[model samples]
Target: MKTLPAQLTPFVRSDVTGALLAETLGRPEEEFSLAELGRRIGAGGGVVHKEVGRLLESGVLVDRQSGRNRLVRANQGHPLYSLMRELIQATYGPVPVLRDLLGGLDGVERAYIYGSWAARRHGEPGEYPNDVDVLVVGDPPRRELADLAVRAGEQVGLDVNITRVGRDEWDAASPSPFIATVRSRPLVEVLTEASDG
Candidate 1:
């Protein structure tokens, strides 16, 4: 076994992280030896070896090996992967329908899943969302916002109620009563914020 590097914090590259994650998601949770993972991603064998070593050291993966072949999985109990899975399941599920609806909205910043769906997915809520509550920020025309919500609702089979607020509203100590209503829902998403503008 190679001795682990003493100082690899700043050296850990995001591109490598992305490549690993992409490769993991590309397959259906099939375990791969380090070398096999490297081949799949077009990375050199040594590089894959090092990356796998780092991931194993971080407790982000668990593995069993036969000879040189190793099988690895994202640690189910690992906090990061758990959270990532939850967010991915929620966002990629019904959220895309809503995201498509916001396509033409100018000044739209970003969308956040903040309410019941998020709460439930993140384990903040005891129950899952029955409907979707979304917060829209930006300068989208009112009609466009309404239309988006309607389309999202129809497509995703959820009651997609969208609340529009400006970036300034979020910065205030307290948002308006209207925003408060959306926030109070079992599930809510702050679909846009100032930084997204």
Candidate 2:
């Protein structure tokens, strides 16, 4: 198992989050069963079901039931989804531009393209992503990363936001049923490699 850094000890465990997302990605058409979701995340089926219910209430996810089974899906049409895209596209898009430029010190580990892009890429294509919402793990230099993002915004119209938080922070927040649901799905559409030094 890969270990998150000490500073990121405050974030939620990406394992469960990633597992749930991977399962969702695998099943493009089927609504995930509580048992299936639990099996994927290595937790009790009941626990997964409860979490899914919580997600539904948070407006981060939506679900429909078929008999005893419940199908859950991310609510991409939500306003925040558009807001996230705008922020990213308005910030970064150019290939050789400043904001389009990623520096070495940005503490970006693995990045996942979640939200609208992911929904469109996996399910049905809707509006093109305005900005890209990337879930960045690891702590890169904040100022440099912000500078690059700002420059990219100025050059290209891509609103690219580097949502880089520590693992510990993630862990701390996930305990909340609301946050856990919000993060129930993927973060962006394209999982790109950070720029080379």
Candidate 3:
């Protein structure tokens, strides 16, 4: 998880907004319903609704009714569309990308980014991290997880290292040394069940 250029951080307000922009406007070719967009970005409907409204008013997003649903998409014609997309990519792309890539995998319960990237995200000053370390709590196959990591890494332009653990191992009353160590560090959760328990 490399720190996005310091200059760009100020321009991007919330991660939720950035994620929405990156997924919709950044892709430009895709359209998403409001509920779908909220789920994809790991944001509640109200938050997504508010941000979408703001972007819509700014002419950065366009929404059209399709049957029973309203599909929202990037306003590719907007003059600042390209610049905004680039900024979202550099600042808030990874978390949503990772969430979309790994969230619904069979058996995946939760995913967290733990390491230098998490540290930087938590506001500790440092150079861009060279890699992203991910902790996956579930029983998904190694090959499957590896393939996902590769794809996610390609999307974010970072090396993604995944560590997996079974539910019992992850939720034990007394955590193992490895789990304890991970828990002690700064962690940016990527995907989690609706109920954290």
- Please, what are the lDDT tens digits per residue for candidate 2 over residues 1-197? 12221111122233333334344433335477777677434556665665566656767467787897777865666666454333322322222232124434455554455556444333333665576555554577777667766665554466756566665655583455533653786443222343232
Q: Compared to the true structure, candidate 1 yields what TM-score?
A: 0.45
TM-score on alpha carbons, each prediction = 0.45, 0.38, 0.74
Instruction: Point to the candidate with the largest lDDT.
Output: 3
Cα lDDT tens digits, model 3, 129-165, are: 7788999998888999999989887777678899999
List model 1 lDDT by residue over 67-173, tens digit each. 76788866676767755443333333344345445645786776555566655433342554667777666667778778877777665456777666777885566
Model 3 steric clash pairs: none
Give candidate 3 regions above 4 Å deviation.
1-8, 42-46, 66-70, 119-128, 195-197
lDDT of 1 at 155: 53
Q: How accurate is candidate 3 locally (lDDT)?
A: 0.78
Report how far off residue 9 is in candidate 2 (Å).
39
| lDDT, candidate 3, at 75 | 96
Candidate 2 scores a C-alpha RMSD against the true structure in Å of 15.5
C-alpha lDDT (0 to 100) for residue 142 of candidate 3: 90
In candidate 1, which residue ranges exceed 4 Å CA deviation?
1-92, 177-197
Query: Alpha carbon lDDT of residue 61, candidate 3?
Result: 96
